[model samples]
Target: MQKQREVGNRVFVTGIGLISALGNNVAENHSSLAAGKDGITKAVHFESLYTETLPFGEVKLSNDELKALLHLENEFGYTRTCLLAVKAFEEAVNDSGLSAEELSSFDTALISASTVGGMCLTDQLYDDANMKFEGSEYLEAYGCAAHTMRLIEKYKINGFTDTINTACSSSANAIMMGARLIKAGRAKRVIVGGVDALAKYTVNGFNALKILSEFPCKPFDENRDGLNLGEAGAYLVLESEEVSVGKRKYAEIAGFGNSNDAHHPSAMSDDAVGAIISMKTAIESAGIDATKIDYINTHGTGTPNNDRVELFGISQIFEKVPPFSSTKSYTGHTLGASGAVEAIFSILSIQYSEIYPSLHIETNMEGFDAAPITEFQSDVSVNYVLSNSFGFGGNCTSLVIGRVN
Candidate 1:
C-alpha cells in the first residue's frame, strides 16, 4: 500500500474497479481515455432487436463469459446485472487489500447503486410472475437490492449494506452516502458505486422517450442529438482517514452536493436551477473558491436540454469555467453506472495530472463560450476535479475529488 498523508475526518479513495466497453479495469479505462478512444459501437453483446438500429457502449463480454470469469457458471439467482456487479465488486475488494476477515467485519459498509438491478432478467421475471407452480430460479433476483444482496451473501459480508436507485444519479448518491458514513465514524471503510446492464426495457423506454441516439453521442456540441445507452459496472473503495493511512490512496473526497430541479420529472429547469445550486453548494462545502477548481467532469448527456442547462449553470458560478469534458462520449451513457465510472475517470486525471478528451464534436454548443477539452492533456498540474451526475426526476449530485499531493 502506498503511504498517504493524514486527512482527518475525510474520506479517501483507496481502490477503484471499472468494467466498461473500454476495458475491464481502471488501467484499461484510463488507457482508452488517454488515447482518445471511443467505446460506442453497434450492440453485439446485448440481446435486443434494436441492436442494429442504435449504438451502445456494451462491454465486450457475454453473460456466459462473465459467469465463467467469476466462477459462477452454475449460480442460479445471478442475472447479467448481478454478474457485472460481482465482477466489479471482486476487483474493488482485491484492490483494497481487504481480507475475507476484514470484509465480514462489522465496521465495513457496502453501499451500491443501480437503475437496472435485476430487471436485466425481465423475461425471466415476467415468466415467473405468471407461473403458479415452482417459481423461476430468478424469483429472489428480481428486486432492486438483488445484486447487493447477492454480493453480501457471496462474500459473507456482515456490514451495513444498502442499494440506491435515483435514476442516473444513483451511484453519485452512493458515493456521497459512503463519505457521510465515514465522516460520522459509522464505518471504517465503505465500498461505494453502481452497476447497470443494458436491457430491452430500458432501451425501449429511452427509445420511446426519443432520447436514444442512433449514432455515437457528441456531448456539448451544437448538433448534439441524444444519449446512447451503455452497460457497465464500477466500484470504489472509500476508507476513513484512520483506515486510509499507509494505504494506496487515489484521491480525497473533498466535498459533495445534491439537489432536485423540481420543475420536470424527466427534464431539468431551463435555467438549470438544480445544477447551479448543486455546484455552488459543493464548492462552498469544499471551502474552496470557484477559481480553485481545476477540471470538471460534466454530466453532458448530449441532449439539447441537458447540455444547454449545464453550461448555463456552470457559467453562473465560474468566472472562467475550468477545463471540462464529458466522458460519456467515450463510454456512451452508462446510466446508473455513469456517475461512478466518471468519478473513477476524474480521480485518474488527478493521479496522472492528465485530462481526457471529448470526441467527435465539430461544433460547440451555442450561446456558450467554453467548449470541452477536445484533446488529451498530459503532464499538467491538477489540484481538484468536480464530477457531476444528473438524473431523471431532477436529481443532481456533484462530487469534488482533490489530489493528496
Candidate 2:
C-alpha cells in the first residue's frame, strides 16, 4: 500500500542550465544526446595520474578558460567547482528572465548541493592549512558550502539559502527541498541544483574502492565492471504557479520522495529496500498510479552493485516497468551534479517527446525482461518522468516531473 498527502501550490520548472562533458549549456548537451555523441574520453584539462590510463567525462574547458568565459578573468579565489556553479547559475537566472531586484528579493531562495566543493583544490587547501604559503586565496573556499556562499555573495541573494551534501543524491535533495519551500509558502521561487568537479581527492578515493572503470561505463550491461568519474554543474529555476504565470514553463515538479535504508556505507542492500521506498513514495506523492510513469532516468552507475539493485527495486514497484535508461552512460557518474543533470534530461523527454539512448550496451543483464532503450527514440508520448538518484550511505531520492497540463 502507498500513502497519500494533500497537494499544495504547484511548482513549475521555469528555467534550466547545465555544463558537463557533453557541452557547456542545455542546448549543447541536448544536441549531443540527440546525435549520439559520446563525451567520455581521456582527460585533457584535469590533471590526474589516471589521465592517460582511464576514461572520464571531463569538461573540455580549463579553469582559466572557464573564468574567462564567465568574464571573471580579473577575479581571484574562484576554484574550478565555483566557476562551474557560477556559469550554470548565471545561465539559469538569465533564462528565467529574472531581474537583479528579483534575485535579491526576500521571496527567492537558493538551494545548491555539492559533494566535491572546493575540495577540488585539495593540494592548495593542504598548503594553506600548513601555512606553507603566506596566504592562499583559496583559504576560505575549502568547505562543502563554499560554492553556495559564492553564489549568494555573487548574486546578492538575501533569501533562504542552504547547501546539501548527501553524497550522490545531494542535488536531488536540493531540488526536493526547494519544492517543499514553495509548497509551504516560504518562498515564491527557488534556484535549485548541484555542481561537482573532478579532483585528485575523489579520483583517488574511488580508485581506492576499486570501482573506477578503465573504459567507458556501460550501464545495465551484464558484463559491466565499474563506473567512470565525471564533472558537471546544473541548475533549474523552480517557481510557484502563481509566480511562474506567463513564463516559459518547462515542466511541473509533480512529486518527490526520499529514504535511507542504512544498509551499507557505499552499497545498497541486496533487496534494494531504500530504492523501493523512494520510487513508491514518489508515485504516491504525485497522486498518480505507478503505471503513469512514462520513463525513468535510473541511477545506473554501471557498477556491479547499483545496476542490479536498482533494477530489482523497479521490478518491485511497477507491474510492467516503463522505458528506463541511465544518462550517466553519456556523462559518466557525475556524483553530486547527477541528480539535477538527469532531472533536466527527464524534462527534455517530456518537452520534446523523445528519449535519449543509453550507449555501449551490447548484452542485457540477465534475470530482467526489461532492457534499456539503445537508440534515439522520437514522436513518443512522454508525459511523466521519474528521475532517481541513489547516493552512498543508502540515501535514495526520486523526483516525478510531468507536463504542466
TM-score to native of every candidate shown: 0.97, 0.98
Which residue pairs does candidate 2 place in steric collision?
Answer: none
Taking all chains together, the TM-score of candidate 2 against the true structure is: 0.98
- For 287-371, candidate 1 gives per-residue lDDT tens digits of 7777889999999999988988998999999999899999999998888899999999999999999998888899988788899
Candidate 2 Cα misplacement greater than 4 A, ranges: 1-5
In the range 1-405, model 2's lDDT, one tens digit per residue, is 344643688999999999999999999999998888879999998888889899999998999999989999998889999999999999899999999999999999999999999999978888888999798888888899999999999999999999999999999999999999999999999999999999999999999999999989999999999999999999999999899999999999998999999998999999999999999888888888888899999999999999999999999998999999999999998899999999999999999999998899999999999989899999998998999999999999999999989
Q: Provide the RMSD of all predictions against the true structure, rounded to 1 decimal.
A: 3.2, 1.3
How well does candidate 2 score on lDDT at residue 86?
Answer: 97
Q: Which regions of candidate 1 deviate over 4 angstroms?
A: 1-8, 132-134
Best by TM-score: 2
Evaluate residue 63 in candidate 1 and report its C-alpha lDDT on the 0 to 100 scale.
88
True-vs-predicted CA distance for residue 323, candidate 2, Å: 0.4
Residue 96's lDDT in candidate 1? 88
